[model samples]
Target: MTQPHLLYVAWGYPPCRGGGVYRALATANEFARSGWRVTVLTAGRDTFEQYTGTDPSLESQIDPSIDVVRVPFEWPAQDADIRTYSWLRAHLPQVWHRWRAALDTVTFPERGYGPWRAPLERAARRIQETDPVDLVLATANPYVTFAAADALFEEGVPYVLDYRDAWTLDVFSGVTLASHRSRVGRWEDRLIARAREIWFVNAPIRDWHADRYRVHADRMHVVANGWDPELLGGDEPGTETRGAAVSPMTVGDGDRSHPRFGYLGTMTRMVPLAALIDGWELAKRRGSLPPHATLSLAGYLGYFAVPDPEMLATIERGRAIGVSYDGPVPKQDVGDYYSRVDVLVLALGAGRYVTSGKVFEYLATGKPIVSVHDARSAATSVLDGHPLWTATESIDASAIAAALGRGWQLSQTADATQRDAARAYADRFRRDRQLAPRLRVLRDVATTPSESRG
Candidate 1:
C-alpha cells in the first residue's frame, strides 16, 4: 500500500513536558509504524523552555521517519521573567493580566493559545501546498489546532479531533466550563460539526462529549493513553515485569523491609499531594507502613517553567518521613525509575473525567498500585480488576492510609499466578494496543478516502 501522509497537529509534542506528550509521541510513532508518512506540527523548543518547561530527552525518542516542524509559540500568562515585563505588568500586574486575558480572547476563546490559530493554519496550509495531506489528526487542549484542521476541511481535506483533555468541560469538576451560547462553546460546536473522527482519552470524556453532540456521537472513539513499550519495556508474557510489573513482593519476607514506593508524573496543583502525604504520615503513625519505608517522587513540580509554590511546599512536608523528591525523569530513563520501586502511586485529581496517563504505565509495571485519588475517579474503572491494586474508599487521609496498607498486603500475598494475571491486564494497555485499531481505520481513509466535504 502507498504510504498515506498524516499531518499530526499538536501543541504538546515531545520536549513540551506534560502528561499528553507521551500519547502524542506514541500516536505519531504508531502512525509512522503503520506506513504513514507522518509530519508533526508543534511549538518550538523556546516555547517549552520559556513557558511550559521542556523534556529534552523525549525529543530523541521521536520516530526517525517522522518529520517534525516546529513553529514559534508563546504563553504570556506563564512568562516568569521580570525583565521582559512592561511597566503596566510590573506595577499594575492585575490590570495588565486582565487586559491580556481580554486581548487573548479576540482571536480565539482560549486565553494563552487563542492567537495560535493563525500560525497553525498558516503552517497547515504551507504543508498542504507541498503535497496532499491524506488525513489530519489534531490533538488538544490548546484546541486551536482543531481550527487549523477545520480550515483544511473547508478546503476539501478531512480531519480528526483528538481531545487529550477537554476544552468546554472542566474535567476535574464535571461542570460545563462554558455554556453552548458562549463563544468557546460555539467554537467547539463548529469544530465538531465537520470532522472525520473525534478521539478522547477515557470513556467518561467521550460520553460527556457524546451527550452534547448526540448527532455526531457515532464519530467519537475512546483512544486511551497507554505505556510506551520503547520506554517502560514491552510486555513479554514470560518476562519478570510482564505478567505483573514486578515481582519484588514475591521475593520473600525479608525483602519486604523498607519497600520502595514511588509516584512518577508531573506534580500539579490539582493532584491530591497533601492528602497523599497525610496518608503516608498516618500510615507510619499507625505502624501500617515501616518507618524506613521510602515513598519516592519523580517528576516536575508543575507544568510551567516555574514550579507551583504550594506543590513545592507539599513535597517538602513529606520529607521528614522518608519521602524523597527526584525532579523530572528523562523519557529514556523512566523504566529505571519504575524498576527501582516496589509499589506505584496513582495520585490524581478527583473527577470522573480525570484519568492520569501515568496509571497505564503504573499498571504496565505490574507493581501493586495504591489509588491516592478519590474512589470516584475514572481511573478506578481502569484499575478495578488488577490483582494487586488498592484504592481509597474516599479521599480522606485515613482512607488513603488504609488503602496503602491494603496495597502493601496485596503486594506481599499475590503469588506468581496472580502476578501473571496482573501482567496480562497490563498487556491490554500498551500504547500500540490502544492505537492499533484507529490506525487501521485511518489507513482505509488514506487509500479509499472519506467523503470529501468540499
Candidate 2:
C-alpha cells in the first residue's frame, strides 16, 4: 500500500527550543516511523534564535525521512536589531509594538501569530498541491496555525488539532480565558467542529474542552507528554531499554556530597521561583536543610533566548540564599543533570490544568521529587504513585519549606527498592509508547471511509 501524506503544522519545531517543541518533533517523527510521509511546516531558524533560542541537539533526533519546511515568520518583539527597524520603530518602540500587535490579529484573534495564518495557509496549499495530503496535524500555542488546517479542511482534508496548551481556557487559573461569544471562542468552535481528532496534553484540559464543546466531545483525546526516548538512551549502544539502570550519580555536581534539590526546564513567569527561593530561605532559617545542601535551578530564566532583567534579579536574590542558577542544558544532557540531583523540585504555578513537560522527565529520574506547585495541578496526579515524591498541599512558604525538608530526608533515606519502583512507574510513559498507538489510530481514522475528508 502507498504511504499516506501527513502535513504537521507546528510553529515550534526542532531546534526552536520552546517547551513543546519536543512533542512536535516526536509526533512528526512518529508519523514518519509509522510509514507516513511527514512534512513539518514551521517558522524559520532565525525566528527561534531571536525569540525562543535554539537547541541543535534536538535536530539530530528528527527522522531523516520527514521533510521540514521553514516558513518565514516575523516576530517584531524579538527582533533586537535597531538598525533593521524602521524610523518610527527605533524612535517609539512602544507605539511601534502596539501597531505590530494590532496588525497581527487582523487575520485571526491570536496575538503575535495571527498574521502567520496567511503564510501558513499558503504553505499548506502549496505542499498539498505538490503531494496530496491525507491528514493534517496542527499543534497550538500560536493557535493561528489552526487557520491553515481549517483551510485544508475547507478543501476536504481531515485535520487534527494538537493542543499542547489550552485555547479558551486558562490552565494557570482554571478560568475561561476567552468568552464563549468572543472572536477566539467562535474560531475555536468552528475549528473543533471540523476537526477529526483534537488532542490535549492532559485529562483536565481535554475534559474542559470536551465539556464546553459538547458537539466535539467524542473527538477529544488526552495525549499526555512523556519523556523523550532519545534522552533515555532508547537506541544508544550501551542502553537497551527506556529505563535502563544507570550509576547513582551521572554528572554535574554529583559529588557535592550534600543533598541537591534541582529544577529543570525553562524558568518562565508561570514558575513559582520567587516562592521557592523564599521557602528555601525559610528552610535554612529553621535548620531544616543542611548547610552544604544547594537548591540548583538548571534552565533558562525566561521563555525567550534573551535575558529578562526581572527574572535575573529574582535569580540573584535566590543566589544570596542557597539557590544556584545553572544555565540551560541541552536535551541529551538532561539525564546527566537529573541524575546529579538528590531531590527534584517540581515548582509550578497554581493551575488545576497545568502540567509542565518537565514533570515526565522528573518522574523518569526516580529521584526524590518535591512538589511546590498548587495541590490542584495536574502534575500531582502524575506524581501520585512515586515512592519518594514529597508534595505540599499549599503554595505557602512554610508548606514549601516543609516539603523541601521532607524531600531532603527522603533523598537521604529512600531505599534502592523504592527507587527501582519509581523508575518502573515512569517506564510506561516513554515517548514511543505514548505516541505509537495514537499514530496507529490516526492512521486508521484517516483511511476509514466513514471519516472521509470534509
Q: Quick one: best lDDT, which candidate?
A: 1
Estimate TM-scores for all models: 0.94, 0.94
Off by over 4 Å in 1: 235-254, 449-454
Q: Judged by TM-score, which candidate is best?
A: 1
lDDT of 2 by residue, 1-454 (tens): 6688899999999888988888898888778877899999999998888788899898998889989998999887667777799988989988998998888789899778888888899999999898888889999888988899999887788899998779888888788989878999889888998998899988999999888988889999988898765675444312454345332334234443577889988878878888888889998889788877888888877888876778778878978677887888989888777777888999887888998898988887778889999888999898888898989868778998899999888877777798888877887776767777678888876676544444
Error of 2 at 153 (Å): 1.4
> CA shift at 186, candidate 1, in angstroms?
1.2
Q: What lDDT score belongs to each candidate, Candidate 1 first?
A: 0.84, 0.83
Count the clashes in each prediction: 4, 0
Q: Distance (Å) between predicted and true CA of 121, model 1?
A: 0.7
